[model samples]
Target: MLEIRPSCERCDKDLDPLSDGAMICTYECTWCRDCAEVLGSCPNCGGEMVQRPIPSAARLAQDPPSTVRVFNPDLMAPTSD
Candidate 1:
């Protein structure tokens, strides 16, 4: 299951699970749409952002999943040409 994060690692913006601005890489590295596009991609793995799946309230009510926080804030460095 995806560990839908709570915030963007770059801008520290809130990333609600149901927000359309939310995006994530294969590693579940979360980021906002702006940062993802401006940065040209995920700096950690150079992967592109894709729509994140939100668990239904019914499912969440039954068994809540774990939330993830950014651990490697420096993993993504500014990309230069």
Candidate 2:
């Protein structure tokens, strides 16, 4: 099951599970559309960035989104290779 993370890992922006602004990598690293555009890929794993699936309101009600926020300042820096 997808963690459906609650915020953008890069900018710390609130990302509702139902919002289309959220992007994710295969490893489930979450980011907002803006940050994802700037990055063009996942910094941690070098994986492609894609849109995150939006869960239905009913499904979201049953399985709440993760409240845990992963903010890494180092991740914001540009990486080589």
Candidate 3:
């Protein structure tokens, strides 16, 4: 089951489980659509990006969305050797 993570790992944007702005990778690392697209893939795992599910109200109540927040500033940093 998806954890429906609370915010974008890049921009720290809040993404409600029912909102269409959420996207996730195979590792369940969450991001907003804009960041997901710009990041291109999960920087921490290099996994494909996909639309996150919008759980029904009952499902949400039973498992409530995760409040955990994740951020990876390196994703937006320029690479250097």
Tell me the TM-score of each prediction against the true structure.
0.77, 0.89, 0.88
Regions more than 4 Å wrong, model 3 = 78-81
| Best of the two (1, 2) by lDDT | 2
Candidate 2 lDDT by residue in tens digits, 1-81:
689988899889999888999999999999999999988888889999999998888888888889999877676777566
Task: List per-prediction Cα lDDT, in the order shown.
Answer: 0.76, 0.89, 0.86
Q: Per model, how many backbone clashes are there?
A: 0, 0, 0
**Better model by TM-score, 1 or 2?**
2
Worst 10 residues of 2 by lDDT: 72-81
Question: Distance (Å) between predicted and true CA of 66, model 1?
Answer: 4.0
Which residues of candidate 1, in runs, are more than 4 Å off?
Answer: 63-65, 71-78
lDDT, candidate 3, 1-81, per-residue tens:
678899999888888889988999888999999988777777878899999989999999998988989877766675444
Model 1: lDDT equals 0.76
Better of 1 and 3 by lDDT: 3
The TM-score of predicted model 3 comes to 0.88
Model 1 lDDT tens row, 1-81: 567788888878888776788888888888888878877777788887787777787766775645666755563566678
Give residue 55's lDDT in candidate 2 (0 to 100).
85
TM-score preference between candidates 2 and 3, better one: 2
